[model samples]
Target chain A: AQSVAQPEDQVNVAEGNPLTVKCTYSVSGNPYLFWYVQYPNRGLQFLLKYITGDNLVKGSYGFEAEFNKSQTSFHLKKPSALVSDSALYFCAVISDTGRRALTFGSGTRLQVQP
Target chain B: EADIYQTPRYLVIGTGKKITLECSQTMGHDKMYWYQQDPGMELHLIHYSYGVNSTEKGDLSSESTVSRIRTEHFPLTLESARPSHTSQYLCASSEPMGNEQFFGPGTRLTVL
Candidate 1:
């Protein structure tokens, strides 16, 4: 079965500092990876996705993720974090195995302190 | 803008009551899904539909049942609400074989 793993439960960083949230996946075929952000009492907003080609995919809100095939990782990153960036982040994966629904990680709480 | 909407943004009902959570999309997408989520946790897919009159259970086992009678509407009904069913229910839609999904604000249910 295809699954995603987010190792960190929470990550704290200072405003303007670089931040990273780690993610890894296990799939039988090529993976379609995605990053989503959720604000308090709000639905998840799509950040970006990696279907093919570029290993580094850029997303909304100045976010980017690097897909490492050999390592089975797709980590979300931002050059400079803002206080408003504090939210819950989820990493998801969908393989070409004919499954329509995405397999999501446990989620990581990002706290960007001002 | 194309959007998905969920009704009863907040609902508090007593246990054993029957309740239905409604989801609709104006985007005309062929696929719609229902997901359950706890606070700051992973979302579990409970139901999905590829089109009208086509509904399927997802990865998670859920007591809620859903129907897709119209392409734009997908309503999930729980015959008897329980404390375990108290969570946020999210609705999403996408095009056929599309990777990106648009989600609704979600309905938060509290079972007392």
Candidate 2:
């Protein structure tokens, strides 16, 4: 079974500082990785995804992720953090051979302090 | 924002009451999914459909039932609302074999 792991329960960062939300995955074959953000009382919004090619994938709202195949990690990163960037972030994965539905990791709460 | 939409963004109902949470999309997506989420938690898929007249249960076991009678509409029904069913229900749609899905504003259901 394909699964994603977000080790951090919460990450605190100062506004304007670079932020990183760590994610790792386990799958039978090559993996497709994704990141999503959820604000209070709202549905999840897609941030980015890595399907194939390009180890560095950029996403909406000045966010990006680096897919490291050797480390089995796809960490979300931002050049600088904004207070509004504070939200719950989730990492999801789906293997090329397994079930089509994505398996999500426990979300990480990002708190960007001013 | 995605063209998908969910009705009754907030719903409160008594236990044993029958409720149908409506979901519709204007994007004409062939694949639609329903997910249940608790506050500050990862979403769990409850139901999904590839197209009209095709519905399948997801990884999680859910008592709620869903129907896909039209390409644009996929509604989930709870035969008996229970306290355990109180959670946010999200609807999503994507094109055939599309990797990313577009989500609708979730419906928060509180069963008392």
Candidate 3:
């Protein structure tokens, strides 16, 4: 079974400051990692995915993630955080057994203070 | 943009009442999924379908059932609504071999 973990339950950052949310995943063989964001009372929206190539993947809203195969981590990052960027972030990955489904992390609450 | 839609954005029902949460997508994706999500938590997959007339349970055990009668319609039903079943239900669809899964607005079901 493949699984992902978001170590921090919540991350608070000052507006315009850089922010980072940590994520680590465990899977058999190679991994296909992804990032999703959920606004209040809304379903998750796709941000970006790391299927193959490009260790550093860029996503929507000027977001980017670095996939570290050695550490089994794919942490989301943004250089300048905006108040509007505050939301719930989730890291997910597909199972190793050729399953069409994805296993998601517990989610990290990002709060950007103005 | 993903054109997936979930009806009854909010639903409240009494215990023992039977109800169905409707999910539809215009993307014509062969794969569809249903997930139960609580506030400030990770989503747990309840059910999924490969195509018409195909449905399978997900990682999490759920009392609700789902049916895939059409390529774009996947509805989840619960024979008896229980307070424990109250949560946000999300519908998602993906291409036969696509990487990203497009999600709907989600239906918040509250069983009293």
Candidate 4:
């Protein structure tokens, strides 16, 4: 079964500082990784995905994630954090050879202090 | 933005009440999914539909039931609402073989 793990329950960073939210996955086959953001009382918004492309995938809202094959990780990063960027981030994975539904990790809350 | 939509964005009901959460998508996607999530928590897939008339249970065992009577509609029904069923329910859709699944705003259901 494909699964995703987000070790950190929460991450705190000051506004304008670089931020990284860690994510790791386990899949029997090649993994299709994705990142999503959720605001309070709102549904998840898609960020970016890694299929079979370049390791570095740029996403909406000036965010990017690196797909590390050897490490089995896909960590979300931003050059500078904004107060508005604070929200819950989720990491999801689906195996190409397994069921199409995504397996999501426990979300990591991002706190950006102004 | 994705065209997926869910109705009753916030619902509060009493125990044993019957309720149905509605989900619809305008993208003509072939797959639709229903997920249960506590606030700021991980998502649990409760049910999904391949297309019209094709519904399947997901990884999580849910007391709710779902139906896909049309290509664009996938509604979930709970026979008996309980406190344990209180959570935000999310609806999503994706085209066949598509990598990304579009999400709805979600319905926050609270059973008292």
Candidate 5:
């Protein structure tokens, strides 16, 4: 079964500091990993995905995620934290063998202190 | 950009009321999905549609039902609303061969 895990329920970071939100996955074959962000009272917005390519994938709003196959992780990162970047983030995964629907992890709430 | 829209952004209704949440996309995507979410939580897929007149239930069992009568529209209907049904319902559409799914603003439903 393909599954994603975001261990932290919340992550707090000071403004201008680098931020990292941890994510790990379990799947049989090569995994399709994705990150999404959700603001208050808004639907989820896609951040990025790692289908097959470079280990590090850049995404919208100056965010990036690194896919570490050996560690079975795909951690989301930002060079500098911004107050507006605070939101709920989710990690999802799907494998070649399973159904098309993505399995998501319990989300992580990011609070960027101003 | 996304060209997807969901109607009744916020809805409050009494229990046992029959309600329909509307979703439409002009992106001409062939695959559409419906997910239920709680505030600041993970999303659970409740239903999905492959195309016009095609619908399938998702992993999470839902009392609600959906229809895809047209290529551009997919609406979910709950026969009898209950407090447990209260949640944010999201609609997403993806291109035929695209993995990235674009989401709509979502409908926040509350059952009283």
Candidate 6:
């Protein structure tokens, strides 16, 4: 079974500082990775996905993620964090097989302090 | 933008009462799913549908049941509400062979 892991329960960063949220995955074959952000009392919004090619994938809200195949990691990053960027972030992975369903990680709470 | 909608954003019901949480998407995606989440826990998939008249249980065991009678609507029902069922229920839709999913505003339920 495919699964995703988010190591941190919460990450605090000063506004305008760079931020990183770590994610790793275990799958049978090539992985389809994705990042989603959820605001308070709102649904999750799609940030970006990595299906094939391009180890460094750029996403919405000035976020990007690097997919490291050897380490089985796809960590989300932002050059300069803003207070509005604070939200719950989830990393997901799907196997290359036909299932096409996503296995989500335990979400990481990102807090950007002004 | 994909238009996915969930009704009753918040619900507080008594034990043993039957309730249904409605989910609809106008994106015309052929795949829809239901997920249960606690305040700060991992999302657990409870049910999913490949298309109309198709529904399957997901990775997590859930007491609620779901039906997909139409291509765009997938509603989940619980025969008897329980305190353990109190959590946030999210609805999502995606293309038939697509990996990216669009989520709807979750329905928060509290069984008292």
For each model in turn, which proportion of the native inter-chain contacts is also found? Answer: 0.62, 0.60, 0.65, 0.72, 0.60, 0.75
User: What are the runs in model 2 whose C-alpha is more than 4 Å off?
Assistant: none
What are the Cα lDDT values of the candidates? 0.93, 0.93, 0.93, 0.94, 0.92, 0.93
What digit string (tens of lDDT, one per residue) describes model 1 on residues A44-63? 89999999998999999899
Q: Candidate 4 residues B2-89, lDDT tens each?
A: 8999999999999999999999999998899999999888999999988989999998999999999899999999999999999999
Candidate 5, pairs of clashing residues? none
In angstroms, give how far residue A7 of model 6 lies from its true place.
0.6
Please provide, for model 5 over B1-112, each residue's C-alpha lDDT reduced to its tens digit, 9 standing for 90 to 100.
Answer: 5899999999999999999999999988889999999887789999988898889999899999999989899999999999999999999998643287889999999999
Better of 5 and 6 by DockQ: 6
Residue runs of model 6 more than 4 Å from their true location after superposition: none
Most accurate candidate by lDDT: 4
Better of 3 and 4 by lDDT: 4
RMSD after CA superposition, every candidate: 1.1, 1.0, 1.0, 0.8, 1.2, 1.0
Model 3 Cα displacement at B73 (Å)?
A: 0.4
Q: Candidate 4: lDDT of A48?
A: 96
Clashes of each: 0, 0, 0, 0, 0, 0
Name the 10 consecutive residues with the lowest summed lDDT in model 5 chain B. B93-102
lDDT of 3 by residue, A1-114 (tens): 789999999999999999999999998868888999999999999999998888999999999999999999999999999999999999998744576688899999999999
Which residue runs of candidate 1 sit more than 4 Å off their true CA positions?
Answer: none
Candidate 4 clashing pairs, residues 3+ apart or interchain: none
Q: Identify the runs in model 4 with alpha carbons over 4 angstroms from their true place.
A: none
lDDT of 5 at A75: 99
* Candidate 1 C-alpha error for residue B30, in Å: 1.1
For candidate 6, the per-residue lDDT at A85 reads: 95
Which clashing pairs does model 2 show? none
Q: For residues A1-114, what per-residue lDDT tens digits would candidate 2 score against the true structure? A: 888999999999999999999999999988989999999999989999999999999999999999999999999999999999999999998888856577889999999999
Model 5 misplacement above 4 A: none
Model 3: which docking level applies? medium
